[model samples]
Target chain A: MSALDSVPTAVSRPELRAGEMLAEGGEGRVYELVGRPGTLYKAYRRPAQLAPLEALIAWEARLAEAQPELAARVRAATAWPQAVVTQPGAAGGTAAGLLLPRAPRRFAVRHRDGTSRLATLSYLTADPGQRAAAYGLALPAPVSADRIGIVYALARVLEAFQRAAPPVGHGDLSTRNILWSLERGPEVFLLDCDSCERYSPDGEALDSGHRRRAMTPNWDDPATPAGANPTLASDRYSLGLIFLRVVGAAHFPLQRRQRDSELLSIDFAIPPAARRTRSLLDGAVVWSVCARSLSTRDPARRPAAAEWVSALEEVLDGLGAMSAARAVWAAQGGGTPAPSPTRSAEQAADVRVRPVAMSGAGRRWERVRPPGPGLPALPQSTRPAPPAAAPTRTAAPAPLPAPPSIVELARTGLGRGGELWLGAHRATLASLSRAGRRRRATRQVIGCLVLDFALLAVIFYMCAMVAGVLLGI
Target chain B: MVNVEERYAVFPFYLCLDASASMAGTPMESVNRQLPLLRAAVGEDPAVAEVIRFGVVTFDDVAHTTLPLSDLSLVEAVPTVVAAGRTSYAAAFDHLRQTIEDDYHASRGKGDRWYRPAVIFVSDGRPTDDRERWQSAHSRLTDTGWKRHPNILSFGFGDADPAVLAHVSECKPHRAFIAAEGAEPATVVPELLAGLIQSIVSSSASVYSGEAQLVPPEVPSMTPIPVDELD
Candidate 1:
């Protein structure tokens, strides 16, 4: 098949054509256009902003060409800058349009306050039921294992992309930017490509004097102060948030708010474990990621995508292993059998007691076991037979050991001058004192006597000299 | 001679990073550049190459597993580090703990013995959410003797809480935490990552050799920033 054939032709027919302007962007007019096929197009009218957009497009295209593998993972540009007729007396020049891919299907979840939050796949897939179905299998109840595996897999993908050395980025990486595909899994596509810049591995700009306007506030990192250009680390911060939301967890690290609000707010709480076997490792991993990425008041502490990919992979591997183990447990007889609702009530009390005792043993095993059932029922084969009559046996008594005094030592070292002993040895101190020889006489007293003698001599001499001079006169 | 079977099971290293809005500008760029260099250096050593697996987890307002643990050889390209969003340390930590716990259990199922895993957390800002859950999870790891108590090395990029990093690292007073002079991810990440990789490699090698003594490699020095100028 021809390379062009690989492109989906079903989208070729545009049913919507640009009839009138819908909105004005800094660089272009967003027009509602109808095309040949029932496709609706947002025809962009080239504005003064087109120059920067054009540059970004060219740079992204070049990078994509240089690295085909990396480019393959990203959304392909449908059309490039093509000269087209424009209405007379437009702003700068003849209008040019670039056809882009349509966004994925999305829905908004309304909050109690009537505000709506866009519930994208990144957020929706995080729901346990949704996640289990999406992956096409019943995940172990202790979902930590599955989460770790997923994180690991994602990390691997990131690493592979990083190694490819493509100047590629998900310019607008948010829940909206991430699309789920049954075949390809989670695919990240770059949107607002015109506003994105090509970066070297060192984060230096390939093109100078180019800055794109910020797109969406929701997609931007909450920690960012107002009116700041998004940095590479900022993108990482956003990516981290996306990961947490996708993994069926509670709350984003940074809460989204209006631009005028405070940058930092610690309000959200993480979800509790559903199973004793469910390791909090997943939560820790997520926290560490967010902490490292978002905790740095300075953007520098955030790990690069390459670095994140590696770290995430490790976490996912752990999760995957846990899942596998859970699966094994289920397959074996180790899994707790489902309990009846009536029995579950009694089991609840048992659970409360067991957890308290288990906590002392430093094992979360009780938590991992299926809930609503008392501890695993003892197997009939393993149950001990009734104890036989005890036989009498004689034992010898042993002597008791003496108890030692328990005096608490003060944390502070020796007393006021005790600090001197930190570096100095007693022998060195004695030798220095002896060598100085100041102990033989009272130096202060001797010096005073010498000063007194000198003063008396000076006074007597001065008086005699003055008397002689007066007599001669 | 020591057999391969008797060699220590190399624990994978995961660096769950916070790349939120707080880590923009210098910090993100520093980390991005440092990651590749670290991988290259680690890959150069045959011993490290055989045992150490690396991955990255980046969090912002939301936590996501950007890089899952994989062999170093699998990474063909470097990831572009972008800074955006808020700090979500708590969620990221939870994710890390869950992932590690799962892996430990799975390894046991396969009859694979595991060495204590290590997580090096680098962040510049504070968590933008409740951290109690993360703290509890961290405590659980220590109490459970799970994978050699999962070494947690935390570095504060700039203006980060030393106490938090210490609490996460669970290392002794002087060894558990590192504070970066500036918020440049590029500068701090390399230094921190080098130490992490070095520690893992040395620890694993010592375990394999039955020496019980593993001297950590010298950490790369950070570009000195004048103390007076930091303010």
Candidate 2:
């Protein structure tokens, strides 16, 4: 996996089996690679531009030889083209597809509805509250240090691509093409790398034959003129756009707005959602870099990958200092105690175990009625438990607690009242004459009334004295 | 700074179903059962759902907007369509013209820019209205002068005439489809719907590729109606 050169390039038609189709889309179908665990075969519906695919493979090989550190990052972060799958035809062969490692399991998130979905960028460019409610996964707070961390990670990956022997532009860096995950810190995985726009170091257009070098709708850089292929500048603009939308947690279209507006004095706009979060970008060098990258009509004015990298690094350092300051303040009792940054031992253990949250009845009900006939089946490991395996209620419920007697109630109530005056005064009336009992009750009532009056008088007196003292002062 | 005219792009798809008596049994049932699945399919893929706005229009002797154009992700369920009366192409076309204009303005007001809207017209019979009336309405709906004119895709089966379907699709290649002569309605309805779901998913994906296209459905039991080229 370290070197793309090691991947076997099949000259003959690869035997693709039916029913192994994992997913299908407009462009192509992805199938499980027989006996090649952790690998998948993506077959194109039409012949793909093999030249660019070959160039991409070679570029990565060169990267591995020259810059192993950056190559490792690119290898881990991208589902990069490994080898060309050519179907047997005239002369040599026609390119059909590519062989690449499957997107790792860590990239998929366990949603609240008992399913694991790819943690795509779509999850990032949404209001955190709505995203959490709809998707059942908690995102990092918008514009928080953690969110900036995500943007930084993305920039780092892009930086590696820009540093290639000949820079590569991820032409369509949209919500679907990139995946985000907090499970292993802030990280992103780029998908659909076969469509990546590549150029040779000799200033030749290596991806000229590729038809998919189109910009995604909302994610497109407005500064990139129509009919133009993606270049480093457009990629930089896209990076800035991603930073804005991801950090702001809103679909910000500042570039589009600027283009459409007739008024020349229009100011740069920040996403409204950014105001809701404690933004780490305020007065930061990263904000300036982001603004310059997005606010310019000329692509050349946009910041480079290295500039973004340095800017983001500075922001991260600031975040670290702020976090340290907060910890110190809390330790000195200047603020409420802060929670530990690392999870408790129990929570750490819990993170490794993923128990099904649904009750047995719910699991059985879901199994009894499927979502739809033609719908793709959930992975076997992710599917709910069967009815027979589920726990059932068989034993009778425990008896209810006995009701309290009137005497017990009275005793409890009297005890609660301190019962000082009424202590040792319990009587049956049978032990005394009726007239004597009546007289005793009357006397008790009068005594209680007198005590209450005395207490109220004291309270009033205290209030009056306090009022007089306040007036004198 | 304040943003003016900031809009997110939305590609609207309007499903115009023929709810004439001819579609009452399996056809109508399949439409109802599968329409919600379209919403679910779009909703599951946020990439598609983010830009795709879907609506439903059912026409018999008259037409009704069962569902207004909306982001499918926000839409909970698609309205059920009942079959009755005779088919009226004029009514369907006229209704579509008005609805598309209204939806466009409303969407623009809410900061949504639209790609050309696509109309998916599914029918089981020829237009009951007069030729002049239906043709006039169709012209109005697809008029070059209209800023919001929609790109139409026509699918027909069960007594449906290919000529009429082709005409409705403006005689465009891959724009019109008819069920193979012997295909059953029960089979055709499901396959058509399943293909439609894929077509829509693909068309929405095409937006990512920079060219938003109206990709025709690949129904297994249907064949594209040929349009003769003028010499």
* Candidate whose DockQ is highest: 2
Docking class for model 2 is incorrect
lDDT of 2 at A87: 78
**Candidate 2 lDDT score relative to the true structure:** 0.67
lDDT of 2 by residue, B1-231 (tens): 322223347789999888889898888888878887887788656667777888877787778777777666555556667788888887788778777877887777766788999999999898887666677677767778777889899998888989888889898888988998877888898888888888888888776554678888889899888886211
lDDT (tens digit, per residue) of candidate 1 on A237-351: 6655555444433223233322334343222222344323222343333344444554435554565555554444444343444343233223211222112112011111100
User: How much lDDT does each candidate structure score?
Assistant: 0.45, 0.67
Each candidate: how many clashes?
Answer: 145, 0
- Total clashing pairs in model 1: 145
Candidate 1, residue A191: the lDDT equals 40
Q: Candidate 2, residues A176-270: lDDT per residue as tens digits?
A: 78887666556678888887776665435565744746776677777667677666577787887787678666665454454563222222233
